[model samples]
Target chain A: MWRGFSMRVVSAFLIGLLFGLGLVVSQMINPAKVIGFLDIAGDWDPTLLVVMAAALATTFLGYRLVLKRGKPVLDASFRLPTNTVIDRPLLIGAGLFGVGWAMAGLCPGPAISAAAVGGPAPWIFVAAMACGMQGQRLIRP
Target chain B: MVEFTPLSGAVGGFVIGLAAVLFMAVNGRVAGISGILAGVLTPVRGDWAWRAAFMAGLFAAPLAFWLATSEKPQVVFDHPLWLVALGGVLVGFGARLGGGCTSGHGVCGMARLSRRSIAATATFMATAMISVFVLHHLAGF
Candidate 1:
C-alpha cells in the first residue's frame, strides 16, 4: 500500500512538472503577458489564444490515442469522468472561475505555475485559493 | 531563426496533457493543484518529499526556460493586491466546490474530454469574463 502511494506521488509530481513546464514553454507563466492580450487598451496579445488552441488540439488527439489502450502508464486504469452530461456544479464553477480569470488574467494553472516568480499578489492569490479549498472542506456536504 | 510558428502552443499543450495523463496513470491521483497544496498544510511525515519536489519543479521550470532562451522573461502584475486576493479566494472556492483546479480539470480532465472538467472549464471561463466585465466596466475598480 505504501509503495502504491509512493508511486502515485511520483506520478503526480511528473504530471505537475510537465504541466508547469508547458506553462513556461507556452509563456503562460507571465501574467503581464496574459493581461496584455486581455488589456485591449493597446495591441492585444493574441498569443494566449494560440497557446490555448494548441493545447486543445493536443489533448484532443491524445485522448483518441490513449483510449485505444485501456490501461495507463502507471498501475491504475484511466480515471475518466463517469458523467457525460453537464450540471449545475459545472455551470457555477465555470462562472466563478471565468470571473476570477478575467479579473486577474491569471488562472489557477498560471497562478500556481508562476508562484516562484514572486509578487505579493500571486502569493496572495494562491493563499486565497488554498483557503477557499480549505473552506470547502469545512462545509458539510 | 526558426520559423515563429503558432504550432508551438499546440505542441506545448499536447505535451502538457500527455505528460499529465502519463503521470496519472502511474500515480493514481488527479493533478489538482489545490489538493496538492492543501496536502502540504497538514502533511504526513513522508508525504512532504513528493509535494516539495513537485512544487520545486513548478518554480524551477522557468529557470530551464531562461537557460534555453538566455532571457528571463519579464514578469509583472498590473492589478492591485486586494483584487488579486479576491480573485484568488473565488478560484479556491470554485475549485473546492467543484473538486478540482484548472490543471486537474481544465488541462488534464479536459484533455481526456471528461464531462465534469468540460463543465468546470466552461464555468471557469465564463466567470472570468463576468469578473472582468464587472471590474473594468461595471465596478470601475
Candidate 2:
C-alpha cells in the first residue's frame, strides 16, 4: 500500500512537469496567443486547434499501447469513467469553462503550468480554481 | 505578429498527453486538475509534500527548459487585473461543477475510454467554440 501511494505521487509529479514543459514549448502559456486565436477580427488565430489535435493523437496512441499490454505498469488497473450519461452539470460546467477560456484564453492546464512563469494570470486562475473547488465541496449534497 | 505553428502545438500536445498516460498508468490516479488543485487546498498531515513537490515541478520545469534551450518566452494579456481574477474564479468553479478538467477528461480520462470524460471533453470543446464565436463575432469585445 505504501509503495503504491508513493508510486502515484511520483507519477503525478512527472506528469505535471511534462505538462508545464509542454505549455512553455507550445507557447500556450501566453494568454495573448490563445486570445489571439479567439480573436477573429484580428487575423483569427487557430493555434489552439493544433494543440488539441496533437493532444488527441498522443492520448489515442498511448491508450492503444497500454491497453494492448492488458495490464498497467502501475499497481492497479486503469480507472475509466463509468458514467456515460450527459446531464446539466456537464453542460453548465462546459459553458462556464468556455466563457472563462474565451474571456481569459487560459484553460486550467496551461493556467497551472504557466504558474511557473510567475505571472498575474496564472496565480489568479489558480486561486479562483481553488475557491471553485472549495465552494463545490460546500455545496455537495 | 507572432507566427503560429500547427506542427509544434500538435507535437507538444502529444508529448504532454503521453506523459499524462504514463503518470496515470503508473500511479493509478486520473490526471484531473480539480483533484490536484483541491489536494493542495486542504492538505492533511504527511500528504502535503507530494502535492507541494508536484506544484514545484510545474514552475521549475519551464525555467529549466528555457535555460537549456536558451530561449525566452513571452506573455500577452490586455485585460485588467480584475477581469483576469474573475476568469480564474470562474474556471475553478466550472471544474468543480463539471467534476474534471482538460487534463483529467481530455488526456487521462479519454485515454481510459471513459464515457464521462468523453462527454465532458466534448462539452468543453463545444462550449469553447461557442464562446470564441460570441467573443469575436457578436460581442466583439
Candidate 3:
C-alpha cells in the first residue's frame, strides 16, 4: 500500500511540474537563447553553460550520496542504464538529434514545455518527434 | 548574445537537478525526456499512468507560471514548419538510436560516471556544433 501506483504517479507529476518550471524560469524555452548558445561559430549566449553546469553539479552531488543508500524509496532497485558500448548508432543518433536541436532548438523537454506558449511550432515538432520515434521502432535492429 | 540571465539560469538548473535526483531516489528512474516520451508512444504495462501524470504536469507548467507571475513563458521558433518538423524527426529518431539524450546521457549518465554517456555526449555536442556552424555559416541557413 505504501509504494503503490498513486505515490508513483503523484511523485512523477510533481517532478514534471518542477522540471517544467525550471525550464521556464531559466528561459530555456526561448529558441533564440538555445540557438544562440549552439551558434558557437558566432556570438554565443553562454546561458546554457550556467544552467548545465549548475544542473550537473547538483545531480552529480545528489546522485553520489543517494546512490550510496539502499534501493529506491519505492522501487525494488535503481533503474540505471547498462549499455556501455559506444557504437555507430549512438554517435549517429546523437548527431541527428544535435542537428535537429541546432536547426530548431527544440528538444523533447523544451518542445513539450514550449507547447504551452507556442501557436503551432511546438505541436508540429512534437508530432514529428513522436513519428520519428515510431519510425525508429520500425527500423531498430 | 541576446538574453543572458545567469542567476535565474543557475537557479533553474539546480531545481531541475533536484527533480532528477528525487526522481531517481524515490522512483528509481533516469528522468530522460526522450525515453520518457518514447515510452508513452509505445506504452508498456504498468508505465502509462506515471508517464501520463508527468506529461500532464509538463503541459500545465506554463499556465501555472502565467497565473503566478502574470507573464507568459517566452517561446520563439524562428524555423519554418517544415524545417522544424524535420528537425523533430531527426531528434526523435536519434534519441531512440543513441539510447539517450542530453538529460539522460549528459546529466544522468555523466553523474553516474558512465563512460558511454560521456562519449555519446561528446559526439552529440561536436555534431551539434558542426551542424550549427554549417547551417549558419556555410549553408547560410
Best by DockQ: 3
What TM-score quantifies how close candidate 1 is to the native fold?
0.81
Shift in Å, residue B138, candidate 3: 2.4
Off by over 4 Å in 2: A1-4, A40-42, B44-49, B136-140
RMSD to native, candidate 3: 1.4
User: Which residue runs of candidate 1 sit more than 4 Å off their true CA positions?
Assistant: A1-8, A37-43, A83-85, B1-8, B28-30, B38-52, B138-141
Winning candidate number (TM-score): 3
Best of the two (1, 3) by TM-score: 3
DockQ of each: 0.46, 0.58, 0.81
Give the winner by lDDT: 2 or 3.
3
lDDT of 3 by residue, B1-141 (tens): 466789999998898898899999988999898899888888998888888888777778887898999998888776678888998899899999998888888888888888888888888888888988998899887
- Superposed by TM-score, candidate 1 places the C-alpha of residue B116 at a distance from the truth, in angstroms, of 3.0
| Overall local distance difference test of candidate 2 | 0.71
Error of 1 at B99 (Å): 2.8
- lDDT for A106 (candidate 2): 77
TM-score of each: 0.81, 0.87, 0.96
Error of 3 at B120 (Å): 1.4
Q: What does the lDDT read for residue B98 in candidate 2? A: 81
lDDT of 2 at A100: 74
By DockQ, highest first, what's the ranking?
Answer: 3, 2, 1
